[model samples]
Target chain A: MFKELNHLDELSRRKFIQYSAKAMLGVGLASTSNNLWGSQIIGKPTAKSVIYIYLSGGMSHIDTFDPKPGWEQQGPVQTINTNVAGIRVSEYLPSLAKRMDKMAIIRSMTSTQGAHEQGTYFMHTSYEQRGTIKHPGLGAWLNTMSGKTNSTLPGNIRIGGSNNAPGGAGFFDSKYEPLHLGDPNNGLPYIKRHQSISEIEMQERLAIAQMMDLSFHQKYPSKKVQAYSDVYDEATRLMRSEDLQAFDLNKEPQSVRARYGDTKFGKGCLLARRLVEHGVRFVEVTHGGWDTHNDNHELVSNLSNPLDQSVSALLDDLHLRGLLEETLVVIGTEFGRSPKINVNSGRDHHPKVFSCVLAGGGIKGGQVYGASDESGHSVAESPVTVPDFNATIAYSLGLPTDKVVYSPSGRPFQVAHKGQALTGLF
Target chain B: MPLSTPQLRSFVFGLALLAGPLASPAEEMAMEEMQMDAMMDSMQMDAMHGMDETSIELFDAAKAVLNSYCYECHGATKQKGDYRLDQKSTIYSPGESEELPVVPGKPDESALFKRITLDIEHDDVMPPPKKARLKEAEIKAIKDWIAAGAIWTDEDVRSGLPTTYVEIGDEATNALIDKINETRAKAEYNAWGDNSVRVDLSVTDKDKLKEAIIGLKDFGTRLAWIDCSYLELSESFYKNISQYQNLERLHLDNSNVSNEDLKALSDLPKLNYLNLYSTKINDDGIAALAACKSLNKVFLGSTKVTKAGVEKLQAANPELTIIYK
Candidate 1:
């Protein structure tokens, strides 16, 4: 009996140390408990949150933020000076112009990949795809760095129909992947309590499950059993968290909804803000159908109008609420449209030159950091690469972009490769 | 496809006999190992076959829904929130926050499950506010993940297993406010804004706006906006406003500044906006604005500048715009 007691004590001590380490690492012990225990950890920044907005299909810089008014053959580009002096944007973005002081536009972005998939992967993960190894996207990197703050809501959330390229926590393990919303276009489903099941019944059922799991846990002393047990506990906590209120759009005022517009993109933007407001560290909202290979102007006008209104409203709303300063808003595309108009009166995908915008966090706003050439063809000054853009964002958010993490294969990789932060923008 | 009790018994007896011989080692062990491998493979096949067809169908349907609707934004191709759903293991668990996506075996506890089931009044609804809802069956599959112990395994293989920054309560809020104020006082400004100007509007009782401005002031140290639209400002207030010499952008757009005050503002070298828009200012005030050499753009759209006064101001400062319309 004494020997058994000592054995039990040893096991309990091990368990205590394991739990302590997991608490220190700031990650859930249900999944990674086996590997994380007994590991010496490094300290990172505490701004463990991210909000990603992917402007799927390429957003045209020429017709949006970077209007080349002096070009003789400028394509339907009209310039309007913003509140920020010496900063002029396309006339289509009047609402954004009013809030220009909250954003930074990069005009001289250059890339080498023209295809949508490649450019999308490059922009999302800051690494050119080599077909050999898949890399994790920026959101995955943040989730890995910060871990989860709540055991209920997903650590990373991607709203809308689908996620972007290289968005998963590749190599880091499948456990770090995002929780994709099944469908967000129609509306939320089945959140109400069922009339058939009384609250007492629900409580009784939960209690029964807890008791069974606890009994099993007492008999079984394996990581697998513990993982299941912990998951059950987490589920109970999630059911009780008031943070569930973050998903309710009706909670927002009517004036706020009208300000965001009555479009899909607008609603997604509002949801993004709401999620971040609830302390969801990373939330990615995608606005798709941007692939304008033909009839670019018509498509851009149709799609970009809503996007402009929604994004502008989001920025202004965030700024007014003071969330913009801590929340970094990025607007970018896979690549850019061709400088020269094609035979179809549209622009083809051109990776050589493009544009992207950054705002909030510690970035300097209302300033055009780079310049395109006279013909809107190539970079004329301070060419910004995809890595540079992402690096600057990570840097401004106080994330260590240069920190290296090894892959499962023992190969070292930095959050960004060979790219410096755009110090001029900040 | 049901097995007879006698067949099952015989099978167990045969398995025990085979194991008994293997326990002695040597050639029997090798033979038994081969048989065991085959039996194990068959058992796996049988287990797969035994899975409820409805559950299998639901799982496939759920996967299809995820691929069609969610993979675009949260799959291996793209992870908007550093999250992917291509694999089962990447489900939400506590990371930096206390939030987890799906708490397996408890649909009510799983945020993913709840988010999908949330009403319009809840802020954490899944599929987002704009997107379509999952099919009834798809929702059932999400619920299934919770029922299945929220396992992160491909085959439910038991073998693999793999900041409170804001505290609650009134006291905590007050403590947080005090700490925040102290930090704000000590916060450094790097070419953004001057920190010396103590614009104490805390006593105004405007909680949300005050928090916004304070937060902005803390992060964006160099930027300041003094909207004296509704505030009753005295002579000393204007003097204090003018003292922020490091002010890069100022919005006195609809302020009650007179020609005298406009003259006083001309001394501000960095004054970007001298918006005397619905205020008492005439062509003489426009002429006084010519002293501000750094004034690149001005909004005098509804001002009192006559055509001749505008021309006079334009002549003095060709870069400036004196509204006549």
Candidate 2:
């Protein structure tokens, strides 16, 4: 009876495989594969690499870079003058204020996408979301431009946790996709040697797996198979190389760790620095859970502590090591909170006006580029678009704004569409 | 005094020279055509000016009120939704979910202008959580722009604007190429020719040392090494000295070389070793050496090279074996 059941299972498996293959053939997998991998080919920036410090939840401009002291009653937080004369920042960021000479604060950042996902997508891709087309994220774009040199560590890496943004190698081949660390705040995952398996046993298992994979590819030569092979190669390379050292935060001394702070954001920032130090072209460290629609004051207060320490320490460390001139640090959020205090004593989603801070990478620091009204209600002067912000960063890193990448349909789209570099900032 | 007949005739001839030819039948017709063209040009200019005035009026009536009260934080300077009123496309497209800020030929679909017109208690009120709302007249002008197909007739119309394409001159192109070459040399990768110094490692390295060097060069290498003493060895000598399947190492010690050949020496990628003991090399040469990634070892004893240069070199290339006083 058991033999009969096994035979039935084998028959069903064979039938399923045949049906799937026929279905894939009908859908034209060959053409699809070409379009998926070969489309949206963007050139690499002149600057070899980038270090992205994404403040996952929207950081308040009033609380960070652009503080309105005269409107203390209207402003939610108290303001203090920074080292740069006439420039003021919230008291919460005293350390960052001292390093104002290293950054350019964009006070008049305006966006219509108030929600987190939309904002993150807009910021990452520079294209307004069209339901039909999914654009490649900046990291993916960079990966395409600067091809991966090391077979071990991925060209693009995201530390901390899974970012909410759909940060895939959109349009570009999935081979250039970002390799997320999952959660660097927690220790490295799935990297330990199995206790039960001996080295000989492990080697035998690997050989068997490789043999099976090779056989499978020989039979079914598809893009998926190619991707699988690429991943396998990367995994093997990682096992052999110094990539494991990237996850080993303990290698960093207690003093250095303390300087970066013990919080998750702190560790993530430290990890980003380490990854960049080791040759990863684009390393994004996202600290999330900043969506504070209700009880924003309480959330920002708690969140700002780690953010302040980590950001200040990262900037100082990069500057001291003379890496700041080359490395670009951007602190941003989805959108700013509503200036008007709600019934819950919180600020709702206000994308009308916000702030984003940019430092290093050849930017003229200690300068405020725009401003909001006295009541913090609207932009009083030069308003910066998402494209402009991305364009400025790209320009500072030596990526030309007019650099165009083509879609599958031969449509030309710039890396940062419709954005001129804020030449004042540089 | 009265002019003579001959002098008068001479004056007439000079006048004729000044007014070279009289209007022929064809010339008269052409003159009439020119006059018509000038009139048309003036009319078009007037129409354009009128459109500009209308657009400016509409903008002042709409943006001035909204931006003054609502857009201080939300305007072009501080775009909150990745949307800005500074650009017409952003204003029209708005975000992924929302309807257009101003629907052409329909005011009812224009959520942005309507929001401002709503009462303070209403959920769809303009400046919902901000300082103030737009006045009735301000809302009316926005309604008018929407009624007139929400046409952006200003000189700053994003569409159809002539993109000023500046053709790069030969000198500029050459300078750019040199900059890229210098960057690559410092980066330590075998110079892949594009517009820069044409150093084709593919034909030169049959053993694939160039490929190995390219493989090793990544974002990490930029952070790790920072000097060019490793690049002091000549490319001609280093090309023949092959050990690794991927890289060619060269050792040049106590070599007779001036600061002038520094550029040529630092340009080579296969260079791995250099010993400039008791040479005339100075800080200038050290500066040039900073771009050479292949240089892993250097000997700078009893040279004109400064202690500062040596210190910087060591800082940039921690793995480099430096022998100095």
Candidate 3:
């Protein structure tokens, strides 16, 4: 019989997974009960959650998914073979290469938006930036379609997100906006009350605050006011729920922690996995600083090392926990760096063609879809637009991509704009 | 089909000049007149390489309807029941075992038209429940687009026409505005008393269209507004109107405003308002208007446009306000 952690007070920090083995594996097992145990349910969606790893600032395609070893634009970067017979990656990503069977790489990811803000917006919503209306991001759309996984936790969380990140919950109510977290290690703030204050006293104080704002809320009765009330209600629920323990990554074992590396991004990935295990439907962990306009090789080498370890570990860890089948892991960027070397020995933004990786979920692994030309300047075949890429992600979650939801402005917007899902990935 | 708005404008102007020898012209015309003639000649040469104006207009109207009403369900991202309206080949041809959604040259027979026009309570009515209803005019536009052969070519017309300003004497300006007013073209001067004026010929008698054309020349750059709806504006009208550099608002709805005429509007850099409702313009014409940076709004109610045309326009100018209602 599997053991479930009923209370946080009884558990030690190191025994997080040991005592809560049932809590982690049970959710997976219960969710998959509809399918016969060990039987593969073909054509049926398996992903109940998505872990989106956004490598903000463009990551160079040639250095990552579309390697052109003999081409001059590839510079001096060397290619290493992956466990997947025909697949290869940069020498910097040896760990990720070994786990290539878990990944499906799209080498011909293309977009018309070359600028960072526009490209990122395009990638997230499958629509171009416009001044008249704000389109909802995929997280919010998925939340609307699938509802919340954990009653106490917001459906979507963004770790290390910046102000410039694409707008969250755009057309959706503010309640749908991603709960932003600056540091994975710090966990959720303001959850614990002062030592002097008792639980009853805290409840009394909250009730008083609500009573004081009742008149103001009645007078205004606006979306902003309602959103303000929702924040308090949600925060209160989260603080009181035992599931909040998922945010405390210090509960993880040292060996498991070390496998993910010591970098901030690595810790963020660990937190994302924990959150998903705790029933979070969407978690975006952003790792910036990839806009390598100068010292491309040196920076990429440093960046790829942590990414390689963390992502590979994430895949293996998810698979071991039997969570891989239900969790879709996506690694993407706004676009890729140009294949041409510039005066500073770095590449510029290249939106014409790029790459992204999809793993777990229903995605077939050990394969690469689409391809860039010899020089890697353009897509030679299977050019996937930003919307197409987004549609594919939505498809994995079994979300209806065609359902049109109108913004507050009465204009229609879809989950993937006008992009067709690359269903061939399955 | 790839003709720039300027080229189309010049060609139409040249044709107009050929049809009706300038009101006053001699072998040795004045320098300004001669220059205008030369400009028209060059535009005509460019127009020779452009697409058919009528077909382009029809395509634009049909496209706008599909994009606004149908694309959410049948577009690139999603194709409920395996029907896609985003692509031309697919929209015109059925991919599944179901009936064809659109049938070129037969709007009545088209499954798309039938569903859209069905009673709101019907099970097969488009936009079913919770979805926004298709405006009556938008439905008419789609029907007209199909009846016009549903020409679905990959052309963009939002690039816009060019603006050319030429000085005219006060006497000439008064004569033109007066001539327009005689045809019931409500010609009003700007409240600021500037050279600008608004000419509304929406109620003008079509029989006196020739007089209205003669009167428009004098207004020139001062012409701020002109509503020639249902006036059957010919090639000459577009050529003559192209001279208005300060022309900002124009209403040619229900007029013969073909792609050729659309090219003429591009020269007006200051033009922000345009109404091509029920006209013969299409995706190609609107694609040309993409060059007109100042134009942000266009009305194309009851015209021939397809979903592809609407996508093209939106792709070129996300800020553009296209009204089909």
Candidate 4:
């Protein structure tokens, strides 16, 4: 069953990139597809799904993953040993510490962009931010590569919210954009019709709109206009399909929900798990407020506690369900915090060296791929660039990083912008 | 002025020190590394503002080397293995093997570097022994050209560079540029043509962070600048940076930069720009920024920076700026 589905996905992926290229350039999709025959899927896929947990604002690397316990740069936060020998995390992350054996920590994540917007853009798209065009995020790229696993539901979803979240399907069709859920408890909204509008009435209204759109679509032939109809059709399909239940978090047992936690971020992670289980290809759960300029200890403590719980529960749940091997869970941020705590007891953004935790999805856990110096300042060994990190994500999913796909204006762009996958992680 | 042969030898020796400051004395440059240094020396010529008489001689010498050993099989006439040595395009293009022959800005990653510099008895050595071999100087010239972003044209590489490129165009921008040059830090602009800038102090040695900040005071009326990412904190650095008024973007990511430093920024009328990303800024600092009316686009990604302070700041300056995470 999996092989058949994967074969189908491969066929669609070929068509999608071609269709996207042709649609963007107003060229022939078939010819473009022929040219791109050898462009994608260069490796065997290790992951069927991805759960990207973005810790918005920079998390303190010195305080969290690459902690320097007795160093002068060490903050008020203490360190604790994890289940994995020699691995440690912030004292606040008690839950994550216990589950460290299940994770592979990359402590030497580096980037050129330090500001939030640019760094976030770089992190998600594997390209620098430019006013000229919006590059597709990893989720959008994944959706383009593997196609949708669930026909009725969106392949990509963004839970909770952060300013300038890199969730947009930049330059791609709007259908690829993440289905943003501002509140997890709220679930997928506007799925049901109004009480006054009967099913027949809705169908009649859709029929009329479709008839009107058909003539206009033929006359105008605009991709945007076509996307409008596609969105409406998908929405209509979703409203009637039973798969829409995946977005409804209330469907989970109360104990399971509690296990993930009652907080918005916790619920978001839980919802992400359900969506992935239901065949959503990509889900990004964002937890904000890691800036920690002032009151760093108090603020990080609050965020880390929930993060520790939600992420641990998600990993544990995935493992128990035998889904961990197929699911790639990534905990990332724009960058990391400064090693030096400020006068107000806060750390600043440090991109020189940071940390990210990757779990399951063919990753060898209980191992650290890279390290920082004694002061946790620069990358000590195995420096991983932002593109390298994103390339690893692509690698796990068997997405081709070297494949060059032309944008709307005929500019060739790679999946991870020249970043080689950290094959050592697998 | 281009260095003469004697000066070049001394300069090459100097570079060996520059490349391995942390490396031990006994571990000197390998033969391949020495070849790379010669190539790098030639590449640095591209960054020169003008072509001096000696530089012309150097290029001519390199062209001569190419003519003597490489021109017969790979030149414009025969183009053996579809690898043409005459034109820049053929040299840069991948050969029949479908791998890049030369990777710009990195000779170490280039295939040409491996083949040409390989041992004489190696199977992949160029010139095939049937032809004349590449001399030591010729090999260095080729390596240098590839390393220096592989410039093919005679035009000075830095000639058409815009004002926003890393070296900066005018005296006003030079302050930050000169200082960054002093330390091992990297200064970058948003794009090849864009004026918005990002200067990273993280690459520099830890001891130079203070000096790097002191140099940024020369950014003058520039709108955006990123300094102090992962730098060890000093109170003096903050005092120097707060003096600028035309500041649009400031990135003090992950340093010991504090609320007091933020308070200094509040006085700059045009200084609503603050990137306290993962820093020590708190509710008081966010509240304190109320004095500067243009405070918009505060990224409180990690709540530790804002904690419970953003709401009060928002209420006070509803019209100031409202973009939040």
Task: Categorize the docking of model 1.
Answer: incorrect
Task: Give me the runs in candidate 1 sitting further than 4 Å from their true place.
Answer: A1-48, A130-132, A149-151, A163-165, A173-175, A182-195, A198-236, B1-325
Off by over 4 Å in 2: A1-46, A72-76, A198-200, A213-222, A407-412, B1-325
What tens digits encode model 4's per-residue C-alpha lDDT throughout A222-258? 3433454566678887888666778888788898899
- Top of the candidates by TM-score: 2
Which residue runs does candidate 4 get wrong by more than 4 Å? Answer: A1-40, B1-325
Better of 1 and 4 by DockQ: 1
Tens-digit lDDT string for candidate 4 (B1-325): 1123343333233323322462233123322332332333333333331223444444456566778887788887887777876765477788787657778767877777777787889987787856667778788987776665665544322122221212224454545554565564545333223344445555454567667666665565553545454466678767666566666556565568777777677657665445555566677667777777766655444435443476777778776543244
What is every candidate's alpha-carbon RMSD to the true fold?
Answer: 22.1, 24.3, 36.2, 29.0
Model 4: DockQ vs. true structure = 0.01
* Cα interface RMSD of each candidate: 20.0, 36.5, 38.9, 30.0
Enumerate the candidates' DockQ scores in order.
0.02, 0.01, 0.01, 0.01
What does the lDDT read for residue A141 in candidate 2?
68
Query: Pairing residues by index, what is the TM-score of model 3?
Result: 0.53
TM-score of each: 0.52, 0.56, 0.53, 0.55
Candidate 1 local lDDT, A66-128, one digit each (tens): 777887655776789899999988777787788888788888888878887888888877877
> Each model's fnat?
0.00, 0.00, 0.00, 0.00
Q: All models: lDDT?
A: 0.58, 0.58, 0.71, 0.69
The deviation in Å at residue A296 for candidate 3 is 0.9
